[model samples]
Target chain A: MKIAFYIFSSLVFVALQTTIFRELTFIGVAPQICLVLVVVAGMLSGKEWGAICGAGMGLLYDIVSGRIVGLNAILFMYIGFFVGVLCKGFFKHKRIVVLFFTAAAELTYSILYYFFAFFIWGQMNIIYVFSKIIVPELLYTTVVAVPIYVLMEKINDYIERKTF
Target chain B: MRYIFEHKIAVLIISLTIVFLVFMASYTSDKARANLGKDGLSTMVLPFQIVFTSVTHNVQDFFAHFGDLEAAGKRIEELETQVAVLENNSRELEDTKLENERLSSLVGIKDSLKSNDSIAAQIIAKDVSNWYTVFTINKGSGDGIADKQAVITTKGLVGYVSEVGAKWAKVTTIINDGTAVGGLVVRTQDVAIVEGEFELQKDLLCKMTYISKGANIVTGDSIETSGLGGIYPKGILIGIIRDVKPETQTVSQNAIIEPAVNFEKVSEVLVLK
Candidate 1:
């Protein structure tokens, strides 16, 4: 039941990421909601659930929206695991931690993505990508992370109580 | 061995990442088969995506209509005058001689162009990695949509369908770097080549190259598809030249074009089947 619930919820995130979120662009760039979902899932759960949920979400997104089959799958999985480890050491309730975690996840995803997707093709424009796309995305994702974290926390509570 | 066994989940995740990357690399090298998975998944998610796309569009339209209402009144008055003039012109067309020549010319032109068969579709999805601005539309193979078909809005050419599924298809827009279309100056009848670039897209422009030294093209000259490629019909409006850089010894002459179709606001498009 927990597995099914996570899968269902993650698909909703993927659906919204592509459809609704694309329309509500913040200065021509939209927040990567699936990235946020993976991070928030890690924060709310442990590394185990985080990795599982991230892989599922990433694979779904890759198949639906990505050019590469498993690119986002691995990228998001690492983010989920890393978030779980970092938040475990820090005060997860703190706003600064949330900002830092979301920012770090976005940064890591963008770097790995640029390298994997563009660097291989000799299209990596580091200055332009970092300044124009990555930094603005990081800021937007960080701001949006607050509400997402709250939603994840509630979802986590429901999952935990149901399982127990 | 015991240490590795003690942390099974971490080991599993690490292994999974490595495996997925290896497989992804293989798939990238041979992307022809990659569409199998994508087509299946897209078909599965079509209904939900359609619902979300429609719901959001309705909500957006609800808000956009409030702004359009005030302007619509003035537009209606202007259109009313246009109707009167058109009605008078239709009455003038009752003269048989002028009408026959116009009809014959239109029929001759239409015979040369394959522009009649078209299907309308609504955009359902778009993502950020879209240096190509890849998007999915609701109609698909079931609706006779196919790959490499031209997509256009009422204003002008929009893009081409790249992938098709059972109930959905993905479109690669004109702003993507990979797209190349044969175009030329409509006024001077000088042919040129147009291509997409991520850099120029920031300014909402595209690059048009291969202009001859004496082409006499200038800023504000209209560019239209030359129909040499057979992918799109001839004479479809592409854009107007925004900036002209004269030919250098090393580089061909080129111009930056501001596309006639406002890509950002494109909601509905017609796919030439």
Candidate 2:
């Protein structure tokens, strides 16, 4: 049942990432719905499942972006592992943490992605991509994080309680 | 970690799936692009397009009503003032027109340089962000705007059609990073590659790269397409050179060029020579 929910959430995340969130972009910032979901899932689930979900989400993102394959997968896996470890230690179902996790995960993803793109992909102009792309995006995604986190918490709690 | 090592199989499966998808996507990209060609999507998108157009028009009308009323009042006042001004300026205009006609004749110009083979197109939508200065124009393949066709206004070059749908075409502007055009400094007669930089800015500008290092260039020098690439015509005005930054230990110089056309103020454009 949780697996089914995961698949459904995954599809919804991809669609929203491509269509709706894709439209909600500022100058250097764009909402990454997939990254948020992966982070939230990481917080909810343990490390292994979080990593798995992140890998799957990142794979989907790479497919959709149509530029630079495999980069997102690598980044998200690390993000999930790190964020999950952080959450596993001493975090409750707090809104601010969830928001922070989401923003941090996205920032980490962008940083790694661009770094790889520059070094591996041979892209010129090694500018500070994160400071521009991630910082503004962090604020935008943080503003959007509260409601999503609340909803995710409810869903996560419901799943844990009901499935058990 | 113990958890990750324990779920090695799941990790492997995830990694394999990604690799497989990437391989499939890379292998099928050309075929997919061919299959999902503009024509294929147009047929699918037509119905939705109509609905979107109608909804947008209705919403625009609804929102524009109050603004239109305010504008109408202002316009009436302006029109009255303009009428008096026009009446006063009529004699002056006639005199000016005579002088302009004489000067134009002396310049040895044909009365009509541009034939009626032009299409007027309105920008339907800009891309999600200004990251790519790509816009969808109302006219498309149906209206004879083919791929690689230049889009221009009375002012100068707007962009060229990169992709064409049935009723819409994506005009990738000169400011888009992926674009490059061979341009000439009209004043110096030196060729350079006009390419877009990553940084987006208010002034519609492009970076002119690969200029001959010793070429005489100055700010305010007119730049135009050299027609070396055969994509654009010989002398479509691109921009004025804002700054010339000569390459260090390289045989090229880069110049900042302010685009001749203001993309923001653009409403209609001509897709032609």
Candidate 3:
């Protein structure tokens, strides 16, 4: 029952992140609450469950977007696996550290996305993505990180205490 | 690492399962694209898009109402200036009406064009990505809006019906990529093709192509439909030419035009033959 609640809350966060948080784009900075949640899931649920959650989120992202047919799937899955491994040691406490990690994860994802989209897709407009999408998005997402971490932490605590 | 190696079998199986699912889904999507022209994929996706758009619009409306009211004030001031100009023109026309009647009688021409076919429609949804200004209007085949029917604003051309639902229709604006208009320059009597680029800000502008370099095209020339294309009727206003340039060292020229209709604020439209 606790596991079900965690999963459902994560989904709600992801939906809001794409729909509502999406409006908070500041130039290149955009809130990536989904990335933070995926990383947190990997940390808490270990490798197998982390991968499952990553795959589910990736599929949902694909459905909402009109572009990138299977690109999100591969990126999110790999991010989940690595983040899961990275979080094994810090699975409990340390909210500040978790917030830092979330920002780092988002930056890493954005940089990688720029490379794949520019180099692989042969769209040499890296400046447009960096200026219009990436930079401003970074500031917005970083600021949003603190609140998201608090929400995730509260949800985690509520589930563990079985206080539903 | 040791545990991962031991559980390697599960990882391999899961990876294979995902690969297979992706392959199958890709294959199905290819088939879906081929059948898309016949099947109504937009209809299936329309409801979700509408709900999401409405939610976003509500949020934007909350923030933008003040700005809109300010703009309305400025518009009222401009309209008053126009009204003063029209009042002067009406007084001048009052004395010239008999002279105009004598000229028309000599030419043996009708006072105005015939026909009163029109249907009104309200805008339902717009793409928020601002990529395609294609909108759904609350009138379709049932409401006398047929496929490819020309949509117009009080000013001029809006777009044409691209797709139809039971009670709604998707009107693809002239600003959508590759949309071409057979338009005639009002003053020069020269004909040219107007085309759309993917860029939305440029919707207020369209590319007027294939004009002969020798044609005396210039900025501020009014462009209208030439009635060459069966899609739109003759004499419907499109835009005023903002600039004209030679397309190449070749035989054609391209002109930037300011569209008559403000796509961003369209609420209602009329469809006509």
Report every candidate's CA lDDT: 0.79, 0.68, 0.66
* Fraction of native contacts under 8 Å reproduced by each candidate: 0.56, 0.00, 0.03
- Docking tier of model 3: it is incorrect
Interface RMSD of each: 2.2, 6.7, 6.7
Instruction: For residues B22-67, write the lDDT of model 2, one tens digit per residue.
Output: 6545643222221243344333333333344445556656988988
Instruction: Choose 1 or 3, whichever is better by TM-score.
Output: 1
lDDT of 1: 0.79
Task: Give lDDT tens digits, candidate 3, residues B232-273.
Answer: 878889989888777667788888888998876676899874
- Candidate 3's residue-wise lDDT over A1-164, tens digit each? 64576457545654455334444545423467666667667665666556666665664444333334455556666677766777777745756666666667677777886675444656455665566556666666667767766776677777777765
Model 1, span B1-273: residue lDDT tens: 997899988798988888888868767532422266677766666677778888998899899999999999999999999999998888887776467768878777553245468999988877534234778888888898877888988888888877777778778777776688889789999988888876766455789988888788888999988988878888888989999998678346888888988877888899987
Q: How do all models score by TM-score? A: 0.90, 0.63, 0.60
On the 0 to 100 scale, the lDDT of residue B141 in model 3 is 67
| Overall local distance difference test of candidate 2 | 0.68
DockQ of each: 0.60, 0.18, 0.17
Q: Alpha carbon lDDT of residue B165, candidate 2?
A: 62
Q: Which model is ahead, 1 or 2, in terms of lDDT?
A: 1
**Worst lDDT 10-window in candidate 2 chain A:** A15-24
- Between candidates 1 and 2, name the one with more favorable TM-score: 1
CA lDDT, candidate 1, residue B155: 87
Q: Candidate 1 - CAPRI tier?
A: medium
